[model samples]
Target chain A: MTQTIIWTVAILTVLGLLLALILFWVARRFRVEEDPRIDEVEKAMPGANCGGCGFAGCRAFADAAVKAPNLDNQYCPVGGDEVMQKVASILGLTVEKKAPQVAVVRCNGSCTARPRTNEYDGVRSCRVKAALYSGDTACSYGCVGCGDCVEACRFGALSMDPETGLPVVDEAKCTACGACAKACPKHIIELRNKGPRGMREFVSCVNRDKGPVARKACANACIGCGLCARTCQHGAITVTDNVSYIDFTKCKLCRECEAVCPSGAIHGVNFPKELDKEAVKKRIADRKAKAAAEAKKEVPNG
Target chain B: MGKLTFSMGGIHPHDSKFARERAIEQLPLPPVVYVSMAQHLGAPAKPVVAVGDRVKVGQVIAEPGGFISAFIHSPASGTVKSVAPRKDLAGNPVVHVEIAVEGDEWEPSIDRSKQLVTAIPDDKAAILDRIKACGIVGLGGATFPTHVKLSPPPGKVAECLIINGSECEPYLTSDYRIMLESPKEIVVGAAIMQKVLGGCRCVIGIEENKPEAIRSMRAAVAELGYPGIAVQTLKKRYPQGGEKQLIDAVMRRQVGSGGLPIDVGAVVQNVGTALAVYDAVQKNMPLITNVLTVTGDRIPGNLQHNYRFRIGVPLSFVVEQAGGIPDTAAKIVSGGPMMGKAVSNLDATTVKGTSAVLYLSEAATRRRPETACIRCGHCADSCPMGLEPFLLNRLYKAADLEALEKHAAQDCIECGCCLYSCPAGVPLLDNIRQAKGQVMGVIRARAAAAKAAAEAAKK
Candidate 1:
């Protein structure tokens, strides 16, 4: 028995050594010449693999970044500029600073504003609900309120307000990853610039119905009356398809259009003080009157 | 002599056909009617008439917009109030022609007499044209343009024409009522369709639960002595009225995945479509009226009705006429309980294929809380299309598109059999429907790409 054990140990050690040599040779033959900087770039990433960078994961982004000549096309919305800076420093490249953005729910059709016309009794999914029919409210172009966006959010940034029956985004936790925006079947959630001091003005309602029909459906529907467009000093506002849109790039945030909006669909968020509606209205009226007077004078001179 | 059923899976939901005995009654015309252009499948018809134009009943108001679309005729003598986008039953924006009813006058071209014209016209093209001009669609709820279905592509021969009288969905009796009331016309319609399909053998498949309909149809076929026409009894099964399911029950054939009924040498039409064909071909009457059943367990027996309603009448008006919405009603479905859409807008008017106004109580309609699947295999067993709903559901949640397509997600008939049979109360049909759509989209895109590549290679 002792001779058998000694022989078994000796044979096993020899077999193990043979296998290790084969593995070493195979690894050398199949070795891929990868840039070591890829590992560094991946280490610099937030490692969330949220796909907010439009890549499969942090590893894929690192692979692409190391291969790319420059980081012009790649961006990580979740990591923002700081992580990008780390990645750029590791790669010895520079990236243009992109303005930080946040998702904004474009619908303001709260439960009280838009009364439920019918009960939705289907799978608790916004995609399923939207595919089945319009929402419980008559305003078809509003939030489905099924918490699909909340489910999609990886950062715990979105939550449904039971009182309003609408999703509220917690700006502090939001990373503008755009997963929630993509999950919204109604296309009511949009990513916009988180402006200087986190202040921004945007048209909160996406309703394209006519004035009377929109007003009848939801109290806060944007009824393309063009009052906001006419009131804007900057040529930022335009009405298309019976819906008013404000160009963020051109908007000066004077808040004149917000005061002139009849349906209160234009929202100004993170402002230091509440808007003085009457005063702003008076200022817009005065400005319109002055413009009309100047146009009359020019006509007389011509 | 055994009762006929499909070879695969099916479920027997309680047939809550409360209004089966109700005779068809003509509903009074509403003062204003909103006729939707999207009454049939395919592209919505384009309106030919403008606001303020006077139209007579049976006059063409909207012309077919695409090859697969149907014409839209005025259901009443009225002045067009407006032609604008309006909300449909699902609250989706569809173009509508609003008209204010003035009188009961009809187009002089239409025959006002109730006489049944038995002579089968020899000209197949003329018969097809008449059917198209009259806007006759499959009233079994799919509303596919009948003209499109009758015209089979080259190299494909129709060996069997199945008239669906199964009325397999619970709480729907419009087809049953028509079979009992106008069996002769339905048989004639079948004969006409058979003639159009190159003298194919015609079989009318009715569920065993509908004994009266089956007996009446059989008697009508016998009296008419129409050659190559027979009435076949189908085993009572949910979704048996589906085009593929009915064809399977009658022809003993299975439609291949991603293939149409025509591919298997069979064509299916609803019994209701047959009646409409008789009207369109024999009387030159446009498909502007249809029989709809208003029923539910909560509805009073006397209040339940099978009304022959105009195409553009509002469901609310019909409900008001047949006793207002029941207090116990929790949900209103536009068709049968199994596959019908829940009605979201009552003010939205009825279209040509509107089958029923079902008022289900909360206890009867509410979905049970979903629990963990117990792996009982009931869903797969009951799937009439032979789909694995549990596996599909898991794959769908995982978003494994390639695996979904391999499992034939596109072949799902969306009959809700899996959902009905599942003890876990999982929303099997909902997820599978979405998966099917996604898979179909992928298949279509791949086909389009292949075609594009072939064209490029040729160039």
Candidate 2:
């Protein structure tokens, strides 16, 4: 029995050494040469591999960045500016600092604002509901309230408010990856700049119905009266398709447009104080009066 | 042969045909009729008339917008109230031509006489032109232009024409009433279609539950002495009237995925569509009316009706005329319970293919709480297209597009068979439908890319 045990050990040891030698030879012969910077770049990444950078994963992004001439198109939305700075430093490339943005639920058609026209008892999916019909409310371009954004959110930044039957965004948790915006079948969620001190003004409604129809459908629907557009001194707002849109780049945050909005569709959030609507309204009226008087003088000269 | 049925998975929902024996009654004209330009399956028709214009019944109001679209004729003689966008039954905005009724004056070109013109015209092109001119579309709950179906594309010869008198969807008896009332016209319509298809043999397939329809159709065929037209009794099964299923039931041919019914040398037309064709060809009357069944378990016996309703009457008006919605009604479906659209707006007017107004009670229609899939194979068993809905649902959750393609998600017919038979009450059809749409989009994109590549290679 002792002789047999010795023979078995010697045979196994010999077999292992022969296999190791073969493996070493194969590895050396067929080795693929890859850039060493790829590993460094990947290490600098957050490694969530969420494809938020428009690649397969963090490794893919790293490989592309290493091979790329410059990092102009590669932006990791989830990693934001700081991580991007690290990546840029490692890659010896420059990346423009993009403004941090958050998803804004453009629809304010709460249960009370937009009463249910019919009961939708189909699949509890916003995509399915949108495909099936114009949703439970009369406003076809409002939030479906099926929480598809919540399901698509990778960071748990969205939840459905039961009382309002609308999605609420957790500003702190949102990475602004735009997944929620993409998931919204109604295209109601928009990625806008978080703005200075998180104080920004935007239209809270997306309804494009005509004035009477829009008002009848939802109390908060944007009637597209062009009052807000006329009130903005910086030409930041434009009305198209019966809806008003505020261009964030040109917006001055003067809160004049918000005060002139008759339907209360324009929303200014995270302000230090509640807006004094009467004073803003008076200011707008005075400005309009001055503009009208100047226009009258120009008309006489022409 | 023994009650013929498709040799595949199908369900047996209780055929709640409460109004099967109800005679067809004429519905009185509403004060105003809102005729939608999107009554058919393709692009919305372009309106030709303006507001305040006088329109006679059967006068063309809208012209076909695309090759697959049908013409729209005014249903009532009236003054045009508006030519604007209006909400349809599903609450989607569709362009409608609203007409305030003046009188029942018809276009002089239409023959309003009731005399049956039995002579089959030999000119195929003329027949097709007349059918198109009269705006006859299939009334099988899919308002496909009938003229398009009668004319198969080149190199595809129709071997058999199946007249779908099956009326297989539960709670729907509109086709049955029409078959009982206008059996001769339906036979003539089938013969006309058969002649259009180079004199192909025709088979009228009706379910055994509709024996009276079968008998009347058979008698009509005999009396007309139409060569090569016969009526076959089908097994009572849900969705047996589906085009592919009917072809399989009658011709024993399986339509390949993403293929048309003509690929199998079989062309199917609903019984109501055949009557419409008969009216269009013989009487030169445009399709402006159809028989619709108002039925439900909760609806009182006297209130249930099989009414020959003019297109563009509001559904709410019809319901009001029939003693209003029942208190026990929880949902109003615009077709069969299996695959009907829930009525979101009763104010929306009826279109050509509006088959029934089914009011299902809460106990009968509400979804039960979902449980974990026990893998009983019931969904697979009931899927008439032979798809595994449970597998599709799981893959959809994972968003695995490749696996979904391999499972042929695009072939799903969305008949709700899987959801109807699932023991777990899982929303199988819902997920599968979404998956199917996504996969189909991918497939279309791939096809377009390949076409572009081929063209580039040629360059």
Candidate 3:
């Protein structure tokens, strides 16, 4: 028992000493200068090195911050104001509190609005179909069922409603990364202010064709006829080349423009309380009535 | 045959060179031609001529807008129908000068004679000036001004000049036909490019697919007894014709990411550029016409009709001449399958950079449903630029801009190699491209921010 105990102790002593030496040498050899600022700057970072700021990652940003004088335009999309405050505190510099952005799909041409006019048998890819022709549906401005956008969204923010052949943005997962926007050839996706109540207003239709041509193509295309602009109390909308652009800065989320659109082309979102609920309900009813009238026109008289 | 090329990743799609051995034939003037001003890279050349102006063949219609831009010329003796906008393959409405071609006429200085001149020129400046004045650019679709290519930036010595005879893009045999028929002129052009590059040792690289071209070019190189001009046969691969790949294949040097061929002590010029140099210097002819290949799978007898049309010939009209779109053909692309873009508008015309009009069946273009990127490494295996496309694609998805920038996403040549080789059929470039743009914007913004900071510090 004595021999066994001594042997065990001796082996333990040697192993322990070797480990201690290794740790000591490793600590010395591979030790980075440990810029005290790196950790501070890192803590201040949003931790999502999603190259929106153009550096390699949070670590790289920290390195750049310590090396360079300021983080003027390096505001993190993920970190936003809170993280920027942390970073500014760490670096003892002033930071801009910029408005955060979220992605909004501009096209609302759902199944009822933009019905499929033809069937396609090839690849189920928006990119492929987009490359091949305008679309199987009569609405050239509408989403072609293939989910290039879904594939493009890294944050799992976009999911295609298989029935509607369109994408739905899950605001929680979305980072306003703009991947889907670039992936979409139709430019039907835009980034807008998330607004105070997680609500936002946007002209969902990106179709720039004239009012008449747009109506012919898609029932809900924004004709850029400037009706939305005239109706806005805050002058939030501008019409150029027959396309209505909502200036998010001036928009008050009143949903007034949605009421005045002849083609129901204007859209409002995240309204204050029950504001414009009646307008949307009436618009939906009128659209159903118009659809019924068209259906009736197609049917033979008894 | 020397070792197969040194490019990191490349694929061998079937080289349906339907027009491989087809003789170069002149395309008779169409009723109307729509020439786009924004043909080459860089800022689009501002139009110098307006609508309804009478233009002779080879007249300068547009001048270079910037250092990288190429000059535009009248394709044929014609009156400008309209200086209007026309849709391109990408559906971008580019400013186009529509020309209603009149009867065939030759430029005053252009030697209409089919005379072969073999005398090697001595003055590099004169040769380069002729090429520059003639507005001859790279003919293999890059359309980089030949003079600019010959004029390397100072302190960067070109060690070896690569004469790219690869003509590797499938279905386009304009270069191959040029090689087979006008072998001497081609040699003279390469020699001129070599001379203009300050007498760098020249190596004419050809893909082994064209054995006859190899044999003919090898014989010509030897017969001329040129000191440095050696014909090297490379393994057949698509995009072997790319400048970086061609440089790597010939010079055995990997071009640094975001670096050009000249950065590696080499200058790679395409075969068509060589011929254009010859025309500009030897014949004093301005660049107005190019031999375009009108071919597809259903094209009868593998019909390789090589027509010399002036830039801006409507692709729809060109397709009609080659017996219109086949009833079975579903998609029309501008260029080869690998690098080509689908033309949404058939009314779009052949620009200076327009190479081949590829017709892919619906079956050829359909994407298999995209599964999660299996990390197959096939994209890496095929990336000619040796980029980690899978990682880059993932980073792009996450919008991890910094990781993407560090990964050198800016170095991506956007050659569609990664997208083509992706087993998931994931639009790898579409994702990476967005990230790349964002990262670049960040870099630019950072640089500007740093400059401002420095300026403030100075103050």
Candidate with best DockQ: 1
Query: Would you list the rank order by DockQ, best first?
Result: 1, 2, 3
Candidate closest to the true structure, highest lDDT: 1
Q: Give candidate 2 regions above 4 Å deviation.
A: A298-302
lDDT of 1 by residue, B60-140 (tens): 999999998999999999899999988888888888999999998899999978788899999999999999999999998
Give the Å shift of residue B378 in candidate 1.
1.9
DockQ of each: 0.78, 0.74, 0.09
- What's the CA error at residue B232 for candidate 3, in Å? 2.5
True interface contacts reproduced, per candidate: 0.74, 0.70, 0.07
User: TM-score, B chain, candidate 2?
Assistant: 0.98
Per-prediction backbone clash count: 1, 0, 12
Put the candidates in lDDT order, highest first: 1, 2, 3
